[model samples]
Target: MRFSLTCLGRKKPRLLASEILKNVEALKTPAKPLRSQEAEFIQAPDLSVNPFFQQLPPTLANFFKKYPPAPFRKYADKPVATNAEDANPFLPNKNPVTGRYAAPKYSLRRQSDLYKAAYRFGIAHLLPKLGNNKKFYEDKHLNKTPVRGSVMFKLTKGERTKDSRIQEVNEALSKADEIIAEHRGRAYRRKLERKSQQTTPWF
Candidate 1:
């Protein structure tokens, strides 16, 4: 339920074999919508945000270069990192039914398979239109394109190095632990087992 990856010498750790097995087990029961709401009544998010595409340098924007906004934020110009709370796809709209921050049915499924399907559906429709428009400045022969009002790449790089990014990642990881603590009893046991195994001396 909770996954932590400690970067070792800048290397990203891979998931443990058993952890992968646990994830497979968790996936056995395909996730479903929490409740049946009028699908039409549910408001979906603006599909303008594509995590991968949006993170690109907009200066390279061209007919084929689409600089989508970062999800949760109107643009990547915000003072937040990739894992910031605002970056959470499930973040509630400014208004809510139950509380100040409540997400609708469609938003609740952002982390689920259903959301993925919808995202693909949106991209399939949007990509072609983007491909056709040659509005952004470009060097036709060289195939070089530049985005209007694009932030310098160095500015973007500096933001990632700021302390805010580290704090945001830590907070996100803590929230994950809280969620896992609630429903991952076996996971906790396994965590302890693995910790112990790592320290046990052999012969």
Candidate 2:
């Protein structure tokens, strides 16, 4: 399966790097220090037993399509009591991970094992979701075209302004100032050119 990761935003690159580091750290059991330039591939198996896998969004759906459902027994319709002392009505004997129970019910250690298994499975299942953001950029040449004004420009001028006269005055003044600035710049440039022409050339 192809896997990739895409990150955007001011700090997203750093966050992505840290996440990668964490995943690499999980490989420490093999007694190897992860190098930054190592190959960008990891082997992960789907050990997920959570029934909630089917309910995940499309971004996660692609990852789970490869793995089989986790092995878990469904919870019974009703709690089976061995004795009045053995069963607590509110504290029903059941597996928290599967929301189900076996004959004698799973002990704390068994339940913890199940949880760890679920966790390993969960990480494997989510790898694809993390990698779904990859993309490729295509470059192309396009013909230049005159850009049309926005639809808002079709509205009557007075429709937007409270007083057209005031707006006209402001616009005229703005244009006048622009023209004045241009004239001043041209005058300064001509003065410099004239000064340069008047300079006596030294042999």
- What are the models' TM-scores? 0.15, 0.15
lDDT per model, in order?
0.45, 0.45
Deviation (Å) of 188 in candidate 1: 3.1
Candidate 1 residues 107-201, lDDT tens each? 33222333233244453222222212233223244574557556445467668688888888889897885567568787886885687688656
Show pairs that collide, candidate 2.
75-100
Clashing pairs in 1: 59-147
| Residue-level lDDT for 160 in candidate 2 | 62
Root-mean-square deviation (CA) per prediction: 40.9, 33.3
**Candidate with maximal lDDT:** 2
